[model samples]
Target chain A: MSTVVLLTLTGLGLAALYFLVASGLALVFGLADVLNFAHGLFLSVGAYGTWWASGNLPGAGASGWGFVLAVIFGVVCGTVVAALVELVLIRPLYSRTIEQVLVTVGLSLAGVALLQASWGADPRTYPRPQWTQELTEVAGARVPNDRFLLIGAAVIVLAGLLAFLKFTRIGLVIRAGVEDRSMVTALGIDVRRAFTLVFAIGGAAAALAGALGGVYAGSISPTGGSSLLIFGFIVVVIGGMGSVVGAAYAAVAVGLLQQFVNYTSPGLGDICVVALLAIVLLIRPQGITGKVATS
Target chain B: MLRIEGLSAWHGEAQVLRDVDLFVERGEVVTLCGRNGAGKTTLLRCVMGLHGNQTGAVHLDGDDITARKVHQRARRGLGWVPDDRGAYATLTVAEHLTLPPVVGPAPWSLEQVHEAFPALYTRRASPATKLSGGEQQMLALARVLRMGATVLLCDEPTEGLSPLLVQQVGEILRRAKALGVTVLLVEQNIHFATTVADRHYLLAEGRIVGHFDNTDIHSREADLLAHLGI
Candidate 1:
């Protein structure tokens, strides 16, 4: 029973991480129609930004309020970078899909290389709050405290996103833009602004994932985001393209399935995920929600 | 008032509109009659800044707006009801009405929209795309009215609608005209056009070939219908 409990909690923690990364990817794709391969770069930036801020920023450190400040700094950095990317790189290409894809692909490759050049390719020990390194007992199973933190954060993000989408004026524009961007512009609303906004939002979420993911893994590396991004993409595909709720559900499914399968058969979890994706696509090509841009 | 002077548009080497000059005065309803591929939609798109491959001077109230973006053109009180109705799958009817920023002085209130389009109010919570074709058309027209558009560029507003719905659309157009909203409409239904429009322009091979008032259209109805291949 304890083993089951541990697996379930651990799976949920992983799911939280996936949700953070995939939510942004889904929104960016849904609203902007940009595949945004450089999303992983934003994740890496957040992880590294938190790492740097912990040691360098005066008000931020590895623990307590200092750590919180560092994460906020990281999120802001990611947001700015994403907004700039949309304005400078993606905006120029506009409706040219092929050019946009190539540019993002190039940016992703160059961004990682630049990070590796600056920070080195080796993994650095991540600065984590002491409480995160501790353990908590749940259902007779000793679970890492970071698992609870991850789950809590994921819940907050999901609720916040839902509320924002439901209540805010900008959120309404985003929902409409995701459905048909040209129509939004035709209605006298500037959709390019919404595009930039979605990019920034996606960046902040991915960066938050990056900062928390470093705590989960106990290390930060240049390639860490790229590796996890594969699963993030899978989660986005399994979920509907632009639905944040769908991404959340798909993340939980993928995380739990990967955890259970990997436990039973060591290296087969990834293969199983691929199989699951294939089955999902075969069954419902539009995804679990069976819609492209719906919330 | 809206005016287009020396407008020429192309679709990758094939010219769709050629030196088309047109204008709609304040509180007037003008219809552009044309066959398929005759650049009627392209002209509307160019005016709305949706089509880029065009060289023209579009003026809204005598101000040159040729360089304006789509949203800018919209902000200038040019409301567009595309042929497809342009409804969003995710947004509800109420959200659709409220999404566009009101740029004009006398935008309709939600209550006014509800009063004008009772059907839309009843389906306010439903997704815009889920509405029936006629309902969608009503929602589309009501959306522009709610935004307080000064000039409406409506493309095929009555297409695929039942006769009853067609009458409803014609009534709405007449009401818009009465409210001092100028309209430039692309329509194939000549009978409906004559009922609502004050004047008409016949477009052929991307050029303005003929101009007529209601009396002229009534006298040449069969010939014009055959010429338009309708």
Candidate 2:
């Protein structure tokens, strides 16, 4: 019972991390119509940026404040990378939806190679800064403070994203664009600008998730990013592709379920995630949340 | 004003339009009338630069827009409200007005659109997908008016509206004409054409077969009916 409870909390915590990273990916694909294979690569970039900034700016007024600086740096790096990709690559591929994937896939491969070249292909740690190293007891269960912090941060991001999408002009335009790009453009707003902004926002969110996940898990690597990317893809598919709330729910469900299966059969744990995704897809071809309403 | 000359377009070589030539002066509410499959919609799409495979010289106030993108043409004062109204199915009526990119300051506002179509004001918060056909059409026109367009291309605006609402929509077109916005209207309803159009072009099999200006439609009713297959 204790094992299930502890592992479940761990799974949920990690699920929170996945939600933070993957929802942005799902949003970009659903709205911008970009395959964005480089999404996970951006997360890796965020983790590495955080690691570099924290070490270089060690005098960040204290460990927590240093952690804050690292996050800000990660977001900045990711946003810049995203905007550049949009301006340089994605903006040209609007009419050719099929080739959009080809370009992004090539980019993702290049990104992975770039990371390997820069960081030597080995796992690197974010050091679990002293402030987060301490453990805590919550509701009689022992939990790592950093994991809890990760969970809290994930929740906050989720809420903030929901509010932004629901209330903002850009968010409303994005929702409409997903329905009819021609109509949105005909209204005289440059849809190209919206696509670029969406990409940047998605990249920034995923970067933060990458930074947080690296610290929570204690390491990150070029190859390590592939697994997170695949997991995010699975979550998006099962939760309903392009659905922010759906991604969150699916992530938690898959995370906990995968962890439970891991206890029973570590090999099957991976299989379980794939199997669950397949089942969901077969039952709801549009995904669990189904197609974006585009309202 | 809008003008097209030697405009040719195709749907992968099936050729929907052939050297089509037409024009609409400012404040003109012109109708392109034809039976089913006469390329009326194709001509409109070509003028709007929406047909993927196309060749044409489309001019707006004497500016050549032959190769302009749809959005570029739109930004240059052209607005198209598709037959379907292109409702953002999940969006509210209020969102419908706000989501499209507005080109400039317009005489119309949310309040004016609401006043023009009071039924919309009553259901401003309702999902667009859930609105009645007439209500949907109203919201569609209202949405475009909010976008500050000088030229409006409305395809089959009254296709599915009630008779009374159809009359009301004609009034709306008259109102748009008074605002000096040029309109290229395509319709199947002869009564609608007779009531609203300043000029009429009868099309048959992707070709213009007959024409009648405002002062002359009465004399050419037979030719119009024969060409229109009405």
lDDT of 2 by residue, B1-230 (tens): 68888877788769877788988998899999999989998888787776778776889989998777777888888888888788877688888887766764564888888889998889889888899888888888887788888898999999978899999999998998888888999988987887888888888877787778866777777777787777
lDDT of 1 by residue, A60-124 (tens): 99999999999999999989998999999999997899999899889989988998999899999
Best by lDDT: 1
Model 1 per-residue lDDT tens digits across residues B127-152: 99999999999999999999999899
C-alpha RMSD (angstroms) for model 2:
2.3
Error of 1 at A44 (Å): 1.4
Worst 10 residues of 2 chain A by lDDT: A286-295
Docking outcome class, model 1: medium
